[model samples]
Target: MHNACLFLGAGCNAIHRMSTLARPACLGLLACLLAAPGCYKVPVTGRAAVNMVSDEAVIKVSQEAFADFKKRYPVTRNRAYDQRVQRIGERLAKVAFWDVPAAEWEFVVLEAPDQINAFAMAGGKVGVFTGLFKIVHNDDQLASVLAHEIAHVAAKHVNERLSQAMAIQGGGLIVSGVMSTTGAGALTSNAVLEAYGLSTGIGATGFDRKKEKEADHIGLIYMARAGYNPEEAPKVIENLEQANAGRAMPPALLSTHPSYPERILQMIDLMPKALEIYRQSSQKQAPQLVK
Candidate 1:
């Protein structure tokens, strides 16, 4: 009986060692399969992002979320207001699309009037609140907001945040299951969603300061290229500061994004380069008609 027990114990140890050695190899294989080709690169910054989710996947998930968002919030039906947003959005999107093709762009103005807020989701979904519209005031201001949001998309900021979250959270069978079933969008768990201020009815959370600064810098260029006044970028920050005064600070700019004061200063510094782009675009004449 003692001899038989010793043999069985040895067999179990051998199996355990084999399993331990195989685990990492299996994980490496899975990672390779999951990894996607690098297609999208951030303009100006030249950072590369993995194109894990296809344009079709982004659009599919965004449309789903957008439909659900509309059901919860009222959409602005004013023809004049909608037309103005569309005009500015189209011009900005044209510049943005130059970097990211297959963008199924659509802009909607939501009739919410609590405080200034705006968001852009994957698949080119953009939402602007009426409260924000009041702050935007004119075409230049509106372009500033649109350009910033477009920068977020162009940089794939959302996906980057999601990837970071997954890394912190442990990878295992559950993550694999979620990825297979839901695509990259599912990686944005509720915690991340709230953090990014993507949730409705909840005061939106802000992003880290670095991301905010990056967005601001890239946004200025996008607006300038699209024929909007880049000088208006700093003005938009000033307006937001005034709009948020007295109201509970939405979130620390540094906490959710770079502090407003610092961002304003940076914009002021970048104004010259942005202005140069604007000037060049303006001086270029429309194509001459054939004689």
Candidate 2:
């Protein structure tokens, strides 16, 4: 009986190994078939990316996930504050398209007073915490945050990151199809992985210092084009530093974003160009406002 049991266990292990090896080939074939012809161009950077998922699908998922988020957390009902955020967000959204185009933009402010975070999901869903509002003192400063987040969406950073994660983790086809059919489920899956930093572990890391720098650079341009002062960009970082001082940094920011000093330096390096853009935009707006 012992020998018979040992033989059965060996057979099971062999079958498991065979199944694991077969999985990748199946995913590879699916990835190849799903690979369409058109390419996506990132805004501001103008860098080309492969269009794996449709924009409509991405938007659908974003909206669903955003709705879920709102239900899970409290949404602020400060009509005045909400309207103000909407105004600034709309302005930045216009500038966001200088590199992309015609994004279906939406912004919401959550009532989470303890969560000092903000994110722009795959489509145009942007969320801000009331906690973040405590740090932003003015419209220009708010523009800085909005532009940075919008940069992520305009670049389709979330989609790119997810695709890379799927490919490396052997879930490429499943993840892509899931993202299309059930946007909320895909985001929920991602949320779990994000909580444990699994994406970073699999070398499908999220934004690094380089990506953050790119966002700062591109975001400065967006804010400037939207008629906000580019100088407000660095100010936003300073505010974050002050707000987070002596407290443990949020895991989400630490894992996915650049350190404050690095971001500040990048902002300083781009200041000259950003200042020039700011001046040009100011001149254009001055004439229009005078009319």
Question: Which tens-of-lDDT digit does each residue in 1-291 have in candidate 1?
Answer: 232224344542443455532433333233334443323467766755433333444456556766777676788887777787898899889888877686788899888888478888777888888788667766877888988888887887765544433332444321333332336355433443443567743635545566678788889998888888887778788888887788666555226677778899989988899999988875322322112
Against the reference, the lDDT scores of all candidates come to 0.66, 0.64
lDDT of 2 by residue, 139-213 (tens): 787788888888877877665545444543543333334333334434443442342222334644455544567
Q: With candidate 2 superimposed using the best TM-score fit, by how many Å does residue 191's alpha carbon deviate from the native?
A: 5.9
Per-candidate TM equals: 0.74, 0.71
Off by over 4 Å in 2: 1-39, 48-51, 98-102, 171-206, 249-254, 282-291
lDDT of 2 at 247: 88
Q: Once model 1 is optimally superposed onto the true structure by TM-score, how far is the C-alpha of residue 255 displaced, in angstroms?
A: 2.2
